[model samples]
Every structure is written in C-alpha cells, then in structure tokens.
Target: MSESKPGFRPAMTWLHSWAGLVLGLLLMTIWWTGTLSVFDKEIDRWMQPETRIAAPEQRISADAIVERVLTERPDGTLSSLLIYLPEERVPFYEVHAEFENAESYRGRLHPGTGEELGDEVSLAASGFLYPMHYRLHSGAVGYIAVALATFMMMVLLVTGVVIHRKIFTDFFTFRANRKSRRSTLDLHNVTGTIFLPFHFLICLSGFAIFAGWYASIPLSFVQLADPENRAVELFYAADNDAYYSREAAGEPAEMLAMAPMVAQAETIWRDRYGVEAKADRIDVTHYGDANAVVEVRRHFPSNRTEAHRDSINFDGATGAVLTNFEASPLRKTRTWLEGFHQVRFDHWPIRWLYLVAGLSGCVLIGTGFLFWAASRRRKEAAQPFKVRLVDTIAVGSITGLVLATGAFLVVNRVLPLDAAALGIERAGLEVRCFFYVWLLTFVHAAIRKQRAWMEQCRAIAVLAVSAVALNWLTTGDHLLAAIGKDLWPIVGVDLSLLSTALIAALAAGRLRSKMRQVEEAAVATHRRDMGSPSGAAGTVANRAE
Candidate 1:
C-alpha cells in the first residue's frame, strides 16, 4: 500500500487522531478530579483528622449561630447558615455572609472544641475544589472555559462515535503490546467508546449544573420577570414574607428555641413521610428581628435525589408557624441531579464506582497527552516557539497540578493551627500553597526540558507518599486506625493516595528507563552506521569503476 495515498477515510482519520490528540489529557483530568470531587468532603475529613468528633449536642441552634453572627457583623448581609448535628460525618455550622462593597461572598465557621464552638469565620477551601473542577474558580473566565470545554467534549463525543463505525464490536478491545498506529487507535477507541455514556451524562450534567449562568444570557428578559433571575432557578426563594419595620424590628419577639425546632422539624419530616431525614443544617434569618424563617437543609449525599434538597418557611415572631413549602417536583428533580453530580450523598459502593470511573477517565486523557508527545517529539525540535510553549503547558499543568494538590494537603498539616497569631489565615495559606506550587511547577517545566517531566512526576510520587506518611505522623491511626474504626473515608482516601503514589513512582521509573534505553539505542545506531564508509556510496563508486 502506498504510504502517501489517502486511502483511509479522511474525515474519520482526522477525527480519530486529532480529537484524541486535542482533548485526551484535559478530559482525563476533568473526569478524575470530578470523580474525586464527589468525595471532596470525605477527602477533607481524611486530611483534617482532628475535626472528627463523636456526635454531641455540640450543634448550636441555628438561631443562636445567626444571633452570634449578627452581633459581630451587623452590616454584612446574611446569605445562608447551617449547624450540622453531631451524627453527621462532617461537622461545621457554616455562615455565608456578604460584606458591603464586596462583589463576592464568604463563609464563616468555628472549629469543634468540645465546649461552645465559637464563630471564627473562615473560607470553605476543601469543599470548593468539588465545584472548582467544572466551575473553575475564575469568576467569568472559569465558567467560560467550562462551557467551551463542554462544547468541545460534545464535539469529541460526536466525532468519536462517527469515526468508530464498529464501536460496539471494538468496545471491549484492548491490545497491550501491539506496536502500530492501529493499536493506539484501538486503545483510544475502547476507552472512549466504553465510557461514552458516562462521558455524555457527566459532560451534559456538568454543563446543566451551570445552565442558569450559561443558558440564561439570551433569556435575561425572561429572568427579569422571575425573582430568581436565571434558567432552572428552582431553588425555593428565601421567604421574605415576614413583617418588618425599622421601629417594630427590635420588638421583644422570643424566636423559637432551636432544640425544640430541631425536634419539631425532624418530627414533621418523619411523620409526613415516615422517613428520618438527617437535618444537617437549619437557617434562621432576622434573629432578633420579628421576621425569622427557619430553613432546614439536608447534608450532602452521593445519591441522585436529595442532593441539593432543602425545605424552609417563615415562623411567626412569637414562635408560631407562618408559611412553608414542601419539596416540590422541580425542586426535587434539581436536588436529585445535583446530588448525583456532586456525589454529596453517595454511600461507599457508589463512591467506589465513581472513583474507578474517574480514574479511567484520567487514564484516557493521560494517554492522549502521551500520544501527542510521542507523535510530535521527532518534529518538536524543529517546531515553532508557540508549539513548544503549548507542549510546556501540557506537561506542567497536567502533572504539576497533581503534585500541587498533594503539596496543599501537606501544607495544611504542617501549617500551625494558630494561623491568626502569625497574621495568616489557614485557608489563605492553603490556597497560596496550592497556587504557588503549581506556578513553580509551570516555571520549572518550561526550563527543565524532558527531565522536568520525570522530575515532577517523581516529585508527585514523593509528595503523595509523604502526604500519606504525614497522616500517620500527625494522626496515630492512619489506615490501620481507620480500618479498626471502620472509617471508610479515612481508609479509602489514605490508601488511595498511597496507591496513587506507588503507581506514579512505578510509571516514572519505567519512563526514565525507557528514555534511557531509547537514548542508548539511538547513539549505538549512529556509531554503527557511521563507523564505516556508506554502503550506498561504495556501491555507486564500484558501478562507476
């Protein structure tokens, strides 16, 4: 067959190669991180072992937390607050408050101290990574990137299906040791094809999660009439029906006590549905003011339904009931989707499945990166600066990101808990540690050449292992302790990190060895070929003679 001949279908050939070439790594990172994000809370629990406390009445009434918050920051707009009961795995009553002249909001919390947990506000760092994968943390830019990535993902999906006409037959095909473009193609197709359903749903749902922001631009006029002001704005609007007046606001209205309120809320939920609802949070607005509404929200679950679920209403000034909205159909649907998407409500089995899927997705993307590098390596030496720049970003951002995240966990353990005394907030320090490490990795990748890739991978392996060791150092229990206590989060997260480190170390070793072998073989071939007169030249000279 003529190598130059355009025998293979042009569109299919281009789609198969370029699609994998373009989106492989990013797709992997998004999938893996997203999977991890499902259990972001669990990971946090593993990292900050100190926060775990036995179920206690340590949960202050939502009303009390609100009252305390108002006393301190009178001008700050209270957005949301919740006090999780002791039985809940992650304990923290969070207060979302917005200060004047600030475009963004902040969450405040008090760490668990056997006694009264004070309202020492801090940013929600660990929980934020879950959203950051898709939402990206970059206000407008992040969402834009997600939206674009989703669109591209859709393109890859469509092209993938089209090019692989026999996708189903090849779905289970994975040939290890085959050395040809066809084998690479098969590997790419099998991974992409088998996970097509998962990829589609995750991508679509991820985009849908932010649908209000992205899809509401053309419908701004529609939102103008709607109070919530966005597409799929199904969350029950905060009931502002409470009677409020400047003069009457300070009236002596004894707000409903939280203990009874909790009992009553749980009773109402159970009696109404014959199910025990885990009330992780309650929101009370206008604490001392006449119009206080008690909003009860459920904790995060990996389950599809009841993820973003909450029920709320206005309680009269004198602790009398005023208004309430039971979970509606639309609200229920949103909750279900959000829950599955967030994996907030997932139990152990579902979480494991998600983890495996996430890892597979990461593999898909990582392979794509390798494919690109392998294909371009010979041409890379002659490529333009722009091409080289992109290559650098690919290497740095992909591998470097993993290391940076591990480093953040390490910093969290090392940084003194008394961060305030040192004029540094723990959350700020953590964020800086993550970003700075990533920044350094990027710079290091640009200057260090191929060696940087290996070095960084080795660093990632080391940091990951060190992070696992640090857990044992900081907390005596480690995986063994978690196993004894049957704490799956700690056990799973710790072991998973350790396993990842070993896998990474093995990969680095193999890559380094392979690179060394390739270099040696190339040198040997050069010496052997050039050691004697060229056979071709000698043959021509003899013919001329």
Candidate 2:
C-alpha cells in the first residue's frame, strides 16, 4: 500500500472529508436556524400573548399610524416603519418605528388601538436569528463566516458528488439497523443523495442572494464602473424624499381627501393591473407646494410579498398622476427573486418545503461530523483528553443547538411579557434566554458521559412539546382552533413544533436503547473471555489479568 505515495482518488477523498468536517457544525447550525427563521413572524405572535386581539378591536389605518408618529415624535427621523394589516397569518398590523439614534424604542401597537397603544415590542429573536445564519451581528466577521461556510458548502456538494460514484443508483437506499459503519453510510447516502436537487438549488440561489459580492467572477464589466455602484444598480433605492422648496400658494390648498385619494389610487391600480393594491401608507411630499407629490404603497400583503403590488405617485396640487412603480414586469421579477430567497411571500406549503430542505442540509452536514469522529475515535482513544474534548465539542454544538432552540420557544410561551419588558427589552431578554440555556446544555454535556447526548435529546423533545402546549395556554389557540379559524400558519407552526418533538423523542429513545445494547454486549464479551461466574470483581480481575 505504498503509504508515502500520493494517489489521485485518495487525495480527492482527503480533500472532501477535511473540507466538510471543518465547516460541518457551522453549516448545520446555520441551516437549522435558518429553517426556523421562515416562520419568525408567527413565532413572535406566539411569544407575545398581548398581541392577539379579539375580533371587535378597532382597526387603525396606516395613514393614522403615520400621523400619530408625526404628532408625537415630529423631530424623530423616520428610518423605517412597517404597518402590517390584520390578516389570518398576522391578525394585527405592526407599526415598527425607529429613529436615527440606536437608543430609540420600538413598540407594536394593536393596529386597531391607534394612539397610546403602549404594548412593549417583544424581541424579534427569530428575525435576528434568521439573518445570523448568513450575516451575523459582527459586520465583516459575520459575512466572512457566511462566505467561508458557503465556499466550504459548495466544495462539500462538489466533492460529495465526486466521492459517491453511484449517486443515482443508491438514491432510495437506507439501512437503519445495520452495522454502525453501514448505518452511518446509509445516513450519509440517504440524506445527501435524495436532496441533491434541493441542495443544488438552495446553494446556487443563496450565492445569488449576495450576487453583488461573489457572483462577480463574471460581472467584472460592472466592477470597472464603481465597485460599490455595481451593487446599488443591481438592487435599487429611491433618489431622495426631499421636499420641493416653494411657498404654498395659500389659496385654500384644494387637495385630495385621504379616502378619495385611496379610491383614486385603487382605480389607477385596477385600471392598469386589473387588481386593487393594498395601500399601506400615503406620503405627501411638499404638502402645499406646486411640486408636491403623494405616494401610496400597497400594504395588505406583508412587505415580503410580490402580488397585488403597486405604487402610485400623484401631483399633490392637482391630484394628477405623476408616476406608477407597480405591475411592471421588471419590478415583479425583482419582487419574486427577493420573495423566493427570503420566503417573505410564501404560504405554508412552500415554507414547509424550505424547512425540510434546510433541515436536510443540516442533516447532511451533521453526518459529516459523525463520519469525522468515527474516523478519529480509535486514534483519539490513545491521545490526551483534549483531543477527545474537541470531538465532544463538535457533537455538543450540533445537538446542543437543537436543544437550545427548542427550549427558547418553550420559554417564549412561558416567560411573562412584563418580565421581558422590565429594564432589558423583551427581544434582548429572549436572546439572552436562548444563549444562556444553550450554554447550559453544552456545560451539562461536557461534564456528563456520552449518555448525556440521549438525555439532552430527550430534553429537546420535551421542550418542543411544551412550546406547543404553551401556545395553546397563552393564545387559547390550539392546532384545532387554528385550523378551524383558517389559520394555516398558526396550525402549521404548532404542528411543526409537535412533529419535531416527536421525532426527537423517538431518536433519543432509539439512541439510548442502542447504547444499552452495546454496553451489555461488552459485558457479555468480557465474561466469555474471562470464564468467570462472579460478574463484578471477577470481571474486573479478568480484564486486569
């Protein structure tokens, strides 16, 4: 076997294994967390019980919310504010207002409860968590990690295809109760093999998400212009919202009423696009000047969707049409791309599909970690404890993250809203709870035997189930109620959590049972070799002898 000689295929195999092993855990965390992030809004709904309002609550118009903000904080620079209209998925429109200063407060008022709606805005942990999968909080470092992990992922997919020669032939093969190596191989093959299409599409599209950064291998032409402008041109922004400076021709500024303006906007949208656009906010630029323009953007479908979408710009003085930025093929295409990558416009089916593919990616990376440990265990058994500790860390992070995320949802439902509101913001508190609990899981696993793996998995199972129950307790909204009310998202979220819990419970049970069987087999093998009747000291003495 000329060990010193380098071989072609062997070198490729080494490249594949090491590349995958190094980035495997990070990729798994990213994928798993990203999957949950699709339902981030629903998760927040489940978390903040007060956000759920009875059917009779007053409906606040987007114009009114804007007026209120302008009234109370006239000096505060409006960075961004989203007013969500009530719907089955999100039964209340959330008005999120942020000022220029980072120390500003954001509140989610009952879309119906207009002025002085003082409910504390809960931490959008799911919102924050989803983005962390790609761009973590550490500006450059976050993107760097995502960039490195993505590069490794692409390598893994390529090398994985290379190593598995019979990719299509073994697509449906799975052996659950076989030898450990065989079982691991089946896991690697089954999860990795079946989802090749999904893996390819998501990875390809994900790179496209940051196309301005990496897809530049071919777009050097654009780079020749300003490198930064290339990115801006791909994604667009308005020129400016500055008012046209001119004194109001103080003649009773005959202008369009709010209701009539909406009616006019709808007529314009329906005439051009054959559908009424959901008007979110109406902005009057240069309120009284001749250059004044009023813009109304559709707000009914969440900000993430692309349909029933249009924007109407009008002359403030004449109410005559200025411009329209909706229903255009080009605008719609951009909307679809943004919606596809973000799952912003997705219904339950596509959301679940994304979740499955994402989880499968996580599984694929997880198996790579197991394969690494299996390859190293024999050598590591002879080395110092630290070598084995690194192995434990790999296992701990992948499994512990699952456990922590499940626990965080459970806490979301159980923790008092007021507790989160005090001193620390609810969002920040929720994040702390997630990390602290996750940290605890790692600490427990590191100290306990490998058996801790099963214990922690069981904990995850319980926490997940608890999250479902907590949702019911807080919202009086069980899965049944959700379905009855046509709340597919609510039903989907709960059922998904329950399904995860059941899967964890089964996996943990199987793992524990198998570990017991392995321990028993070791005992029986020792007895046979020693030929001793005394099972305790006699067995030890035989091994010593």
Candidate 3:
C-alpha cells in the first residue's frame, strides 16, 4: 500500500505543503497586521492623546468649522477642500485643502469648539499598520507583492482542501497532546478547515481591490504612450466626460452656500433609499467660477455592509442640477466587494469575529510552517545548516514578528511630540524603530538558534507591558479612567495590550519548561553512553548490536 501510487490529491498535498512553508510567514504578517487593523481606530485614539475627546452632545455645524478653516488661510487663495465629518470611530472633523499660493493643508478640528487638533505625532495603527497589511509600506513593489501573495493564497487554500478530503471531520479534530509534528498539523487542519471560506473571501476581495483595475483598464502609460490603444483619449472621453468637466470661466460668479446643497443631497438619498443616509464626500470642480460644479458622492447609510456610487452633480455657482450618477449593478457589486474587504462599516460583533477568524488564520499559517520543519527535521539531520535555517526562519517569523509589533507600540508612546533629530521626524523614527527591531530579531534568531524562541517571547511580554504602561503614563488615560470617561476605544487598546503580555508570558514559561526537559533527557543519554565502552565504539557503528 505504497500510498496508492501517489494520485492527484498527493500531488496537491505536495503543492500545499511546500507553498504553505514558503509563503506561510508572509501570509502570517499580512493576517496579523490585518487583525490589528480591525481595531485600528481604537489604536489611533490610544496613540494620539489629543484625539481622545468624547463625542460632543451635538457637533458644531460644518459650515462654522469651514469658516474657521477659511480664517486660518486668510492670506492664501482657496482652490479646493475636502471635509471628513465627525464619525463614531473618529470623533473629529478632518479636512484637506489646497491653496493656489501655498502648500496643501491637512488637519483635524475639534468636534465642539472647532479648534485645530494639531498634527498627529504618531502614525499609529490607522496610518502604518493598516497600510502595511495591504501594501507592506513600499509603494508599487509592495502593491505587486501583495497581489501575488493573494493569488498564491487562493491556490494554497484550494489545494489544501483537496489534500484534506475529510473537511468536516478535520474541523472537529484537535490533538494538542500528541507528538509535536502531529499536534501542529492537527491545529493547522482545524483552523484551515473551519476558516476556509473566510480566508478565501478576504483574499479574493483584497485581490479584487487592485487586480480589478489591472484586469479592466488604466495601464496609464501604456494607454497613453502606445499608439495602439489611445488609452488616454478613451479614458478622458469616458471617465472625464461623464463628470462633464469644464474650464474655469476666469470671470467669477457668486457661489451658492454649500450647506443647503449638502442637506438637499442627504434628503434625496434618504428618500431614495428609505434609510437615513449621508454623503461620504464632495468634489467641487472649477470652484468660484461660472463653470463650477459640485459632485456629492457615496450617499449610503453609515453601517451599510456594501457600497454603491450614488452621486449628484450640480452647477456650483447657480445650484442647478447637472448629472445624477447611480452605479450600474455590475459596478455596485464590485464596490460592495471592495467595501466588504475594507471592514469600514461599523459593527462591533462582526469586527470581533473577523479578528478571531483572522487570528485563526495566523495560527493556521504558523502551525503549517512548524509542521513542515518538524516533519523534515529527522530526515534532514545530515544537513544541519538547512535544518537550522528552517528553525531560524520559523522563530523569526512567528515570535519575532510579534516581538517587533510589541516594540512598535512601545516606541509610539515613548517618542515625544514633533520630535526630530538627524532629519527624521517622530513618525519616521517610529517606522525605523519597527523595521530595526524586526531586523534585529532575525539576527538574534540566527545566532541564538533554538533558544531564540523563548528569549523573544519573554521580550514580547516585556514590550507589551511597557506599551500599556507608557500609554497610561503619557496620556493619563489609564484603563479605569478611560472607562469612566466613556473612552471605550482607548480602554479596549489598553486591555488588549495587557492580554498580549499575559499570553506572551505564559508561552515563555511553557517554552522554558520544555527546554529543561530536553536538557535533562540529553544528560541522561550522555551518561548512559559514557558508562559502556561498547556504546562509545557503537556510536560510530550506528550503535549496532
């Protein structure tokens, strides 16, 4: 019964095992960061102390807020402005404005008093962790790498299912007390079997976010530079002309008040959808000119699971209706998918489930890496370099990655506001700290060998506790105080940090105990081998009888 002549499923098993081993670390990195991103806003509030203000009983009018912005730029000519109104996750008014004579401006404003919230001193989870999940913090190269990883993930998942024919049984099975390799594979199977659909959906939607563009249009340079496609001409003719873009009349016309137009658009959306809805953003083209137009877009209920492109264009100066845009069903389906991928809509329960499932994904990948190494360890004993390389990678990728993230959070609270030295700003310094710590973990793993895992876990515990303590010391928002002030997001972050610390400490203790047992067993074997002259010469003759 030589494994039934190694059929299609066996071939798939080979593919699944090898692919999982090679890409497992990358998938774990993406999944872990993505899990953190589920609570990104909460993390942001914890990182940026000034933004911890509770939501006002009633927010100040948007018009009044805009007035303050205009006052700040009295000397410069305003060109365009984009406003993000106060929301549940971010309890502040954020704005981006361009000036004809000055640099572009971006800032947050108080929800009640309309004062500036000042520049964010830290990149936090929203700025760095979330982007890292999608792009790995590099520009085009990172984007392409993410796309390729996502595609490979799909292949891995499908082949994994094919290899594990008893999916339902596998979902129910767990053997934590078995031999190390067997237990590791059991954990991998349970997680992969149960979260198959979720992992597949996340990957598909993520790939679609950018892959759709490549699949459909906009090889921009190719479209424009190549004589064959005339892509630029086709783009503007369709995408631009649809907006009915027009030149500024130079001779100005009195602009209509924007508040009323926004209200009207909201009302139209409410009536059309039979639900209270609000516009996501507005784009004003040719501002203050006769040909000016305002596009109010993405009028959907805040917590809607999906998205649609619902927009209305208006003659900006005269307040006359221009073109009303509603997405085609095909377009609606795609936007819905993109929105689903983002997890932007507010739902605490679903978000928690996503976090749990995402962590399970990490476990699945991590265990798969472990099982591959363990299965090959005995067979590859002759090649200690290869075996050591695999172990180093396993330790560095699993505990090492977690250790780096702990350092990142700790450093965020440790760095001072607007701190700059040697040309790196506070935010840049934070990023450098993350990569530097991450790189150090690999070096530490290679040098320390098997002991690196336990050491790194202990370090993670220390860093996690330090992050929580520093957050309290710097922001004066200890967990109990945050709870009293109804700052649940900050409280959640604090509690999560403490939990991570506890988990890391427990893992470290277990690893220490395991190492001691292995050491004791080796000592007993060495003593027995030394007690017999035959054993010494036998070791050279395979210890043969």
**TM-score (C-alpha) between model 1 and the true structure:** 0.78
User: Which regions of candidate 1 fall more than 4 Å away from where they truly are?
Assistant: 1-29, 57-87, 95-128, 180-186, 219-250, 271-274, 299-308, 327-331, 378-387, 419-424, 484-487, 531-545
Please list the C-alpha lDDT of all candidates, in the order they appear.
0.61, 0.65, 0.80
Better of 1 and 2 by lDDT: 2
lDDT of 2 by residue, 314-363 (tens): 77667777676654565456445545656755376777777787787777
Q: Give the TM-score of candidate 2.
A: 0.77
Kindly indicate the candidate among 2 and 3 with the higher lDDT.
Answer: 3
Those runs of model 2 whose alpha carbons end farther than 4 Å from true positions after fitting are 1-8, 53-60, 67-88, 96-106, 109-118, 212-323, 326-335, 384-387, 420-423, 479-488, 528-545
Clashing pairs in 3: none
Residue 124 of model 3 has an lDDT of 89
lDDT of 1 at 484: 80
Give lDDT tens digits, candidate 1, residues 5-111. Answer: 46544665576557665655455455656767767766767656655444444555555665676666666654334455443446655556443345333333443
**Best-matching candidate per lDDT:** 3
**What would the per-residue lDDT of candidate 3 be over residues 1-545, giving only the tens digit for each residue?**
32476687778889888888788778878888988998898889888888999888877766787678889988766667677777888889888877778567788999899999888788989899999998899987777777778888899889888887678766788988766677788898999888999999989888767754454444665656675776555755543333556677887776677767778888887888788777766677766678877777763346688766677888888898788766667666767777777777778899889888999988988988887887667666567688678878888889988988898888888888868878999988988898899889989989987678889999999998898889889888888899899999988888888898899899889878876766665556668777675434333212110
